[model samples]
Target: MLKSRPNAGRSQPKQQQQQQQQQNRQPQQQQQQQLVHTTSSHYGLEEFFDSSRNLGERQVKSGRAWRTDELRLKSNSDLHKLWFVLYKERNMLYTMKEAAATEYELFPSPERIDKVEESMANLENVVRERNNAYWQLEVSPCATGERPSIFRRDVFGRHRWHKCSQHIPPYHRNWHFRNTQGPGKTNETDWFFHKYREMKRKHYNYFRSRTARYLRDLFRRFPNADAEYIAELHPEFPQGYVQHLKENHVLYDDPPRAATRARIRPSEDVQQ
Candidate 1:
């Protein structure tokens, strides 16, 4: 009973110390809580909207898209920032347009989306041009400097640009590279290539035949139309066929120009 009493006495002070430490921590936590600013978390979300335009505004005047020359003058870092800005603007516009559409209203200045898209395309082309120039100078030996790719027939027999990786000289003898790059010589591939060629041939013939039919109808309807100009549009027409059309037909209208002219008798000049 005496030993148990001393143990209990030690435990009571430890418990009191813990309670005091917790009491001290409570005020610090309370101070931190008090110091924290109570700003709304979504305060920055207004960025996705055009503040200048009212919800019911019929027209929102915006500037033209960034031209290629303008974008080329910008540094890479500027381009990077502009890309994000345009991206965000596009999103904002899309959201606003959707909101307006949901209410069955016309979105203000829909052409703004086109301007944004054009700017984005121009920006990408600028970046791509820069990349191509750098690669040509530093990394690639190919003309485009955009990693040399060969027209490879895939396993599906569709031609795809198969990008080649660079290596030390004498790449031809590298059997492993050759084997890995192309489609395997299998029965399926052989069959596919045959069918693929047939499909391509059919596609080519279909278009050419359609062009011929169109040319025939065009020549029938408007014989006075320039055969040379029509030939320029589709130069595949044989020279003989074009010359035949030029010589035989003059007009598809009711009467030929030669036949329509009223005769003016030469007797008037004789009398004078």
Candidate 2:
């Protein structure tokens, strides 16, 4: 018995090793069970999964968007888990959608996409708010320098602008001038400005052509239509425009040709 197992250190029995592996896996199995237990307690997660399951039947199973306060209260692990669940559900829905499209059938619960998207948007907003707050408190400014206020003139050289922020340091009071060159004086020849001018010119030309054509047609339709009234109504009309109509027999009627007297009266008198 003492001389015992000669090669005991060399190799363990297969059955023993199998038993040890089972023992090792027990803790992992318990941990997995705990993970499941924790996930089941999350808010709305079960409902989200349920809605996903009925995507083939329902058309409006999407839940409301998550609010920031609620997200802020959630633990990091829970949020992480939720992200993965949402991701999986999205993939599942997308797969079903593609399949339905291929079969030319309705992929029920179309609004689920919108709901998921809204939730994602809300989540991103919450994250951004928290991130900004954290940065402002801890880092003293955004990762990039404080966002500068911006101002710009409209295409028509008009003042139309917005102020982005108000954290200008006293030393950089001249930052605005440094970044923005060229005086604010109106420059109609600027690319956008010129484009706007050209657009206005084309629009005016179109109206002018249309007005002239309409007036010509009106005279043709009713030779004695109101001319002076129109001229008075549109005093801004070009002087040469109305004059051209008068010269071309457009605005005024022509004089009738003179009638010739018959020579019959003289002939009759001579015969008498």
Candidate 3:
């Protein structure tokens, strides 16, 4: 037979060889490399960046954070899903923010971070409320189904609402608790506690009196305002409290008028 052409039966090109190898790969191997190939707009690490549409935009319009009422309506499973979505969104926003900082670029719509955090806090609070309710219904000894607390001194001698934890022995018997927390009742602590109580009492009294005075003035200024609505808004006050204040304004420390007509009026004597 005639000699074979020089190019006949030659090896396949490098690109064609790679294509054949990829095609011959086992299904398991392909799955291992990538779980599923989808025709999504963004892929891989790009998912964690700002969207293509908003990449260079100065402002991005968005909705407000999810409210507690809205979240409460969702079931546990739905809440779980939303939580992950929000988490991923938070991560993406943070990544973009950090990148901007590194590159001396302005992070657009910084309030997005605040909105995300607020939603997260609301979610946490909702979960806590549900947990507390569940404990109250099924297992709690205390009224709140939570830790019991008392107004007590901290290590620094500062008084606060101290939450008590379960101990093998009573609080008095537990030395670890005592040493970790400050020594409870001594002359020095007693003196400080008394002084702090006095100061707090004075501060509270000042506010209460001031609030009462303001209520009286408002009542006097707007005699026809909805009394029921005002009372509802400031329910801390007794039912007849504002009326009593209006009748006896002098009982409050606030003066009726600091400057009189004689002092503040356009007068020739004052000019002289």
Q: How many Å off is the CA of 85 in candidate 3?
A: 6.9
lDDT of each: 0.81, 0.65, 0.79
Number of the predicted model whose lDDT against the real structure is largest: 1
Q: Score candidate 1 by TM-score against the native.
A: 0.56
Off by over 4 Å in 1: 1-56, 91-105, 132-144, 165-184, 236-272
lDDT of 3 by residue, 95-118 (tens): 999998999988889999999989
Q: Please, what are the lDDT tens digits per residue for candidate 2 over residues 116-208? A: 767766666666676677778787874533454556663346455544544455425756553464234455436666687789899988988
lDDT string for model 1 (121-233, tens) is 99999999988888778877564655667987765656798877877755578777656655657788788888989988999889987776666666777767787877777
lDDT of 2: 0.65
TM-score of each: 0.56, 0.35, 0.50
Worst 10 residues of 1 by lDDT: 245-254
Better of 1 and 3 by lDDT: 1
lDDT of 3 at 198: 92
Query: What is the number of backbone collisions in each predicted candidate, taken in the order shown?
Result: 0, 1, 0
Preferred candidate (lDDT higher): 2 or 3: 3
